[model samples]
Target: MTSRTAQNGGHYGAIVVGGGQAGLSASFHLSRAGIDHLVVEKKTAMHKWRDERWDAFCLVTPNWQCQLPGHPYDGDDPNGFMVKHEILGYLDRFKAKVKPPILEHTAVTAVERHAAGFRVETSAGSFTADAVILATSLYGTPSTPRAAERLPDDILQLHTVDYRSAEALPPGAVMVVGSGQSGAQIAEDLHLAGRKVHLATGNAPRCARFYRGREVVDWLWDIGQYNITIADDGMGKKRHDTNHYLTGRDGGRDIDLRRFAQDGMALYGRVKGVSGGRMLFEADLTSNLDAADRVYNGINALIDRHIAEKGIEAPPPSVYVPLWEPAEEPAELDLAAAGITSVIWATGFRPDWSFVGLPIFDGTGYPVQRRGVTAVPGLYVLGLPWLWTWGSGRFLGVAADAEHVVEHLTAAVAAPRQLMAQAG
Candidate 1:
């Protein structure tokens, strides 16, 4: 649904959809640059951060890295992690601080490229705008496999978004599918909380916990490690998610896995099917897990040299032990023996633009764009992971990208604007 059109008048210079970080960044820049724009958020203000996360959620990034354009977090723990509530409050205060024209609870239903610019439609109302920026994240929608539909009713299956805390779960053995960040973290939490856990494996990259006396993420920015993708080869794009550098799902960012396995969490390659009160799991997660382990060692060596050369001295980082040995091939997991009950599918998410029938999307259903600018003039995307490079899609990295988008947003529609002199 959409909100009613502005009471005073017509199309805004720009309209931004979704009020998440990406949208906030874009909107904030537009505001500072003196652009008239509206930020439309469908859910309750900061609903994504407030509801989507478990209470224990803390940003993997230290507060120092949580900087946005024109505003940064002001707190004692700049070097510490920002919890979900902190982030939500920060955004809330940021929104209040800026007070940009925002339409809350009003969702954008359609955006047809109009000859003038773009015709926007929302539950509130409709108007034409010079451009539209989709900062709504690609992860807003939860993805479920076709196999999930076939799972019998006896098995309680829920996506990671539905998961709040271990207490949200019903009592029973649980199969936590997908071993990516959320999958691994959730499995570890539930297992440690005393639920029997089975993790379905898939391809995952890994990372090191610390490098040269600091959290590895610090090195990611300080040394411009992820920036390496700016000069990436054709091979890098194909393996964006699989690439070894940042793909490292090292538990150092979340929770350690060596300790996770020690708690009796069962590992499997992948989940193939489900029937009765059971689901089937395979043995393929080992290769990706092993690859992550190898990379961790490689990171250690790099960090070691940095320490010696730079005279960096501090407590040693915890050594990452590979939790599971290399599984030769697939093996079927019997839920009975595994003591599996509810299945927490912590698999990742992607965009749900299916309802948005726009020609701007390419073969992969991803918008074709150079940076955030799309092939369709007056249409743009912001906050997409790897939109330009490995770091382009991250929260810390979006500021540089937001500048690029704002520049285009301002210059592209310089004409027909109601100048301050003209307005009076």
Candidate 2:
């Protein structure tokens, strides 16, 4: 840990905002390049993994994917999934090894372009730097649908970030909105805990945890799926838009919506609106389910083709059949009659860049950058979805992306000095 007091109003070669994997990685590379930098964090390191996750939460990806810059996973169980504690431990060890200059509990309030390069205002104090790397993860704010406001006052609403466990929820049937990974897993958790779960299905893709005698993630990695950069112009847009629905339970398991339906989870299409204390759903539940099925099958087909082309021996295909019938879904669901006392919004999240006083954001509020390099010279962003590669935002890819960003930062820091020398 660096001296927080020393950083107050001090100038540096660069400043990395955020102390998670992305920030830590950036610090590592900057230090390695002999550049002076400080990593400012709002809370303790790996705050989200420590505080935001549920009790039973485990990484969907295998332990092998837990790759940091210098600290790679040399654990005994590479195929197993790491729980929350395990992840925190891994990060703690990485922080200890790297020993980057980090100021804990220091929150950045504002970032503005300054003559020195950038002026960063934080809870501690203000500092100027020649470069700034915004390493905050993509999902900074939990997003709930607008319809949530119209729900009855008696109905308790909690976003996925606020949800800790099923025991914390009120004793009644629960409606979990959004069928993404968190929603699906939470619905299963609530259902198993004796609560009737109503899941609003979305267009998230699903895949079996294991396929053809190998983990699906392993297969994807072997097929260079993670290495597919946005620059390739191949399935990058689609991959960036879609969220994969799988679970890290019972070693690893598939979480299809049909399975939840068969297990007594009331499945509905996207929640369209709310009126008269009644929730309205889209009538395209079957279509949404079919779309998910297509994605699942498509992944399997790709694996099959890879196996055939590579001459690798693999098990025969084990087809999955839909258990739920496609019937006319009710257009409206009465909240009172349904006995739903609580609503858990698993709708997902969006990045919060309100503190950044720069014109680098796009029309959609996402930062406009090319592979972490912002339009502004001294500004950079890391751990953002599709920032460079398909896995750019993930733990497995953050280190590599950080290295690339820091390389640019190195040259960015030198340009001014070179110009001054030339003029002299």
Candidate 3:
């Protein structure tokens, strides 16, 4: 790129790019540590969180768990899950409290390595800092599979990220791809809205928020799960582990699929490919359905253990069976005959790093860092779940991770920067 230089230079101690939860949390720590820094956010105050989320979306984590140091959630319903709006509100309020010198409505254009540090160029201006922390999230892109690209133009295909409401959907039947939370939720929603719905199920795994009537999070914690940070293969393991649980149920409560069957939603095995205005796949959804059952049993067992340990009198949750299942293989559902004109892909998301010009990323689009420390000097990450523990990167546990990262960043910038003193 162009040689790094700036004309109007008022040197900043550090610069943070992207003002998402990760960036804001890092900035919060920097402020508490007495570090003077500039935060460059691409959008207006908290727009990233507010504008991007779909309708009726609540954080997968409970409201009580949403927090940052000195800025924990203190709303009326602590136990309920916070919506995207509430989260955006909290971040804006936090930014105001810290008042980090942020320049909004400007996107980072390019970043070049300077002699002493790095030169960060933005829409509004250029800034030089001793360290640059990029807080752009992994969920930056909406990944559509290649097979989906071959779909006929007549059928409507939409990623879950872009889907807002049933009003946006065209008339006829709806076929939801993938069996993840979004797929289950959207399928359930569309079905209840009085549309013929076909759920193209794939590698689905059921989850329980509570098993045996005890919170699933508590069970995972008690069993020392999510603690496995830094697996043996490191980047390979991290990339492989990135995925969402298919079950919409949490704490043993039904989300979408539990009641979806009651609305006449049909379950089918994987969709192999689409051709001749028809979607072909094996009707033998036997193994896939079996896998779902296995997970249900496993979660129930965990709850049973919890009950036995606590000596609770209540019985386990009663299982609700699905309405219909495909019995044979290579089952073909003509998109036209099924009257399914639209496809909603709630399959899952994979991070894209085409814009991120850092060498620290692995092939699978995950950042290469050990507890947020990168091979590139002065490069650090915070607010990643399971960065050091299962909870480290999760909503409930991210505050502690942010605390650690802020502590480290403060030391990185404060211990040096003697040039300013000498120049003064």
Top model number, lDDT: 2
Q: How much does candidate 1 score in TM-score? A: 0.86
Weakest 10 consecutive residues, lDDT, candidate 3? 243-252
lDDT of 3 by residue, 1-424 (tens): 1012333455676777766666767777777777767777777545646775566566655566666657778788765666656776776676666565667777887766777677777776777877777666555566766768777788899988777767788998888887766676677667657888888777666666555545565566666555555654453345344334432223224443534655577777777777777777765466766676667667667666766787778655555355444445547777877788888877666554454456887755677877777676666666554566656555556666667766776677665656567777
lDDT of 1 at 285: 61
- Stretches of candidate 1 off by over 4 Å are 1-9, 229-258, 302-330, 355-358, 415-424
Tens digit of per-residue lDDT, candidate 1, span 343-409: 8887778787653546888777777777788877678888877777665666666777888999988
lDDT of 2: 0.86
The lDDT of each candidate is 0.70, 0.86, 0.66
Stretches of model 3 off by over 4 angstroms after superposition: 1-10, 84-92, 221-228, 231-239, 242-252, 255-263, 282-284, 306-325, 418-424
- Local accuracy of candidate 2 as per-residue lDDT tens digits, 43-142: 8777888888887888898999888999888678899998877888898898888788888898899999999599999999999999999998777889
| Residue 161 lDDT in candidate 1 | 81
- Taking all chains together, the TM-score of candidate 2 against the true structure is 0.95
